[model samples]
Target: MYKKLLLLLLFFKCFAGFAETIRTDVLVVGGGASGVAAAIQSARSKIKTILIEPGPWLGGSMTSGGMCILEGNRTLASGIYAEFKNHIRELYKPRLGYDTTTNAPLVFEPYTGAAILKRITDTVKNLTVKMNTPFTAVKKDGTGWEITIMQSGKAVTIKAKLVVDATELGDVAAAAGVLLTAGFDSRTDTKEELAPQNATNQIQDISYLAILKDYGRGIDRTIPQPAGYDATQYACLNNADIKKMLASAKLPNDKYLINWSDCANQYPITSDDLNPENREATFKKAKLRTLGLIYYLQTRLGFKNLGLTDDFKTTDHLPYLPLIRENRRAAGMVRMVLDDIYTPYTRGSQLYRTSIAVGDALPGQHYSIPGAPHINYPPFPAYSIPLGAVVVKEQENLLVTEKAMSVTHLVNSSISYPSVQMTLGQGVGATAAYCIFFETTTKNLKPRIIQGEILDFKGMLMPFADIKTTDRDYRAIQQIGATGLLQGIQKPNGNSARVLFMPDSVVHTAEIKPFLNEIYSRAFLWFNKEKPGELFTIGNLLSYISEMTLRDPKNLQDGIQKTWKTYYKFTTGFDATRPVTRREFAVLANRFFNPFARKVDMSGKFIN
Candidate 1:
């Protein structure tokens, strides 16, 4: 009996060794655009990283889905996404004669974009790219995670400290049992201007995109008729609404993106496409619908010569995957709503301190249910993406990227764009690295620390053209603006009144009184009696800072005097009537944050 028990122990130990094991500091699942960025950033930080992509290629919708044409302006694209665009320009500059000086090389072929991603990721020393591998299961192994992935019909186990769900559909989040929501949210649920009264399990229709080759003139290139092809099913193709949508969907290189409003293959009715039960059948139906759309374009619209391009060779002429607009969004620590984008953050709010990523894409219209209210998002300025939106609400050691992020359906439409997704990915990667470096959880890591890391990578937490890098108090001013303490008050500038943060502009008592009241809750009632156009004084600035920070006015004054005596040689008596310039206010503000500083610089004294 003793011999038999020893043999049993040996057998179990041997089995454990036989199983494949891979270890890394960060394991990013789903090699989509965000996943690729996350893996690159994490590995570049010197962490052992493993990136698993189910598809053979990288660049999710940005590449395989044939979304090569970049969206948003050059100001919006920064960090890794900007680097990727620059690399693409380098690859095609000789071939296409695109000007390297300008940021106009936003368009590229599908294969070229994918190849660029592959080549760039291959150069990272600590990153391991596992192609054609899908995440099967994940469980908490102590404070970390042990993930099971299926690669070539064999299961491989990977142990990692951090896991990011960069899947286009939030697969890893679901597998980890993270709190998630799907479909449309009600007005009561999110208080959004356009959300319906009652929530519904309906999402924006996904498109099976096809890149068409423009073979100028006429030539017979009609594809075989798709199964169950019907003529009456697409009577709305000629409608005015569809014609406008088609015009917007047109791409360069004589190619037309076929997914348009009220026409072709946009599946409006919500079905089991996201449900695991009927996923396969739903995918087939979607593919057939696209094929039918092509037939309509050729036979009905009289474009017989236009043939489908063989860009995605793996999936015939169509893209390797469908362009999914919405999915199960993980409930994060901070859920981003329309207000966060359309309006500015309130002063002294936590949201202001945590702004990490920035995006400028306008929200796209949602057409999940027929006859649903077609809500439109008004044009807004570029906004910051808070770190709370990426950290999972309840789950530990996990972060979500792409459409799975914590945002309302309306905000999702804007952030779902590949460029924005990459920004969020880079932020997440940096946050993950910080968490690993500091030996802290995502919940415990502060946003300011993460923001510092993002800035180090040349990321734009706030990408305003007016905010230059050379500003003396750039970081402090950015922090203030981020908190919505002082928004750009619109002033007339000839033809248009553009809102701008004129940092050099002096602040008057009238402008600062209302903000002080908002922050201090009417603590200093005497400020209401100040004269109009009176310049904010040094004494007023000190009192306001002391009150805002809940410090005793006399104590703060004494500390400031003592610090000034230690730092400066020619300090006389305190002057209360001296007008405080913007630069002086910045110095006082900086000192307020770091009261223990032994030395103070006065370079900003010349600033208005």
Candidate 2:
């Protein structure tokens, strides 16, 4: 360990001159779902961009990290998130001629996800994605950022006008001196009803997910046993209810993800933790811990029949990715607080002003469990991610991405999914384009301007509806509400006569499928393209948009019409011939917009 530390120190000392400094319109760190979208958006905008990922492969959750299962509303997705799934569907399905039962074009594989990221980056000139590059530090240089990165034992530098920290953990922002809070800060501090009464520093333990393929009939395939398997020490999640039912041979849903299945703290560290100060040691520690997890599952539990597969395991069970849970968040113009989540009271949210993308999902797990290893799905309030959430408080040029953006612990629990993370990435990308076009700095932009830009961006809309009109923040609220970007709920007095907009009420993607499709149908008409009368696969449209947006960043408008047109033209192959797909106006849910984008309704269809 001493030798490794000394070697690292020496390497840093000698690598000064080797640090290459370049300039770009945007700098995206971390190549996960959000980072990929951020890079794609910036590159598509024709803006110079540099993307750095610590791992050799892309797709932090899907590839190196082994998070293949996409959570949240798959169909509610409109931008990069939609495109990724669509590509997986089209690329994998066009060859197979049939989709897997999940209705996803095909089940995703890690490498395929990685290659798709590479393909998008390679196709865009403005985007330059580098593998095995870990960010070391970030400095605010008055104009933008001076970011230092390490690769191949050398330091490289980038002077970026905008920086997106899509790292699974908020490494850059924390290093850059953003005011960061970890774990549960407390209800008094966070103003969250759900905040634990007692404050704690223990962030939820990151999950090391394993992909198990069941061949049906209780027959386990010859997948290999994971490395360092021991026969006497493994333990599964041990859910009492599941254990009782296990006698009947059934496993509950949560346990399948291996919640508390093993004690993973014993694994060794194999890489840097992406922290400049001690990432190498931290990462090496992570490796041993991960190995311990796999060991417990195989030999310790006597799952002799269970084996590992390199095809999925990728260089042992040590996920090439880190399951990060927290990061530094900029104190943006408007912090979406826990108070905003109550369905009974909150409304006229200033969030309506700066929302670029939006979503609603429940925060899943808490760190400390009351019993037996863990607890099942716990419910929290639904919420939206506004544009201000990703912009740093003082930085005039940068936008955050993925797990790096601002979110109180309450909402962070919900927005951390790879799909949602990708949505935020796309929103940041479009915003970067807007920032470039307007020659404006991110910090200088307001909610209205940001809203306008997003409405005109290239991705599809998450459903939103404005429950109120003629209010001071009407323009902002209506921008989302008119197009059904947010949802309208009962009035505070429980009277339906006067509707109140409960912007804080959490709405899941699953609840808004009808609204999503309605918006898509309108999108078809607005783009003057053919809308296949049949159930159109969301992926086809997503791919076309991604394919184009990856090249043209400003189709960046999210006004329902522009978004619809972009997707419609991309999907129907507009030969200037196809009966119009819509004849009437459509209204989407004010229920919930994917918490990441601010969309526009252009067909004069959704303006409330």
Q: Write the per-residue lDDT of candidate 1 for residues 463-559, one digit (tens) a residue.
A: 4546544454556555555444455554443422333566656667766566445444554564654443488776787776765577998888777
Residue 81: error of model 2 in Å?
1.1
What's the TM for model 2? 0.65
The local distance difference test score of each candidate is: 0.72, 0.54
> Which lDDT tens digits does candidate 2 get at residues 1-608?
99999999999867755547777778888888888888887777678888888887888876677665564534345556666777776765654334434323224666677888788678788678888888877888877788988867977788887778777767777777776555555668766666666655444445555543333444443435444554333344332343343223211221122323234332222113244577555655555545555455444443434433444445654466556544444565455665454441234443533456655444545443233122222333333466677877755676666555666666666677677777777777877777776777875554445455444443432232232122233334445443343454422322111233544343333333344555454443423453333333233233224333343423322333354545333233332123221110111212122222433221112222
Error of 1 at 52 (Å): 1.0
Which RMSD does model 2 reach against the true structure?
13.6
Judge candidate 1 against the unseen true structure and give its global Cα lDDT, from 0 to 1.
0.72
Q: What lDDT is reached at residue 66 by model 1?
A: 75
| Backbone clash count for every predicted candidate, in the order shown | 1, 69
In candidate 1, stretches whose alpha carbon ends up further than 4 angstroms from where it belongs are: 1-19, 92-105, 239-254, 269-272, 347-350, 366-369, 463-465, 468-477, 483-485, 488-608
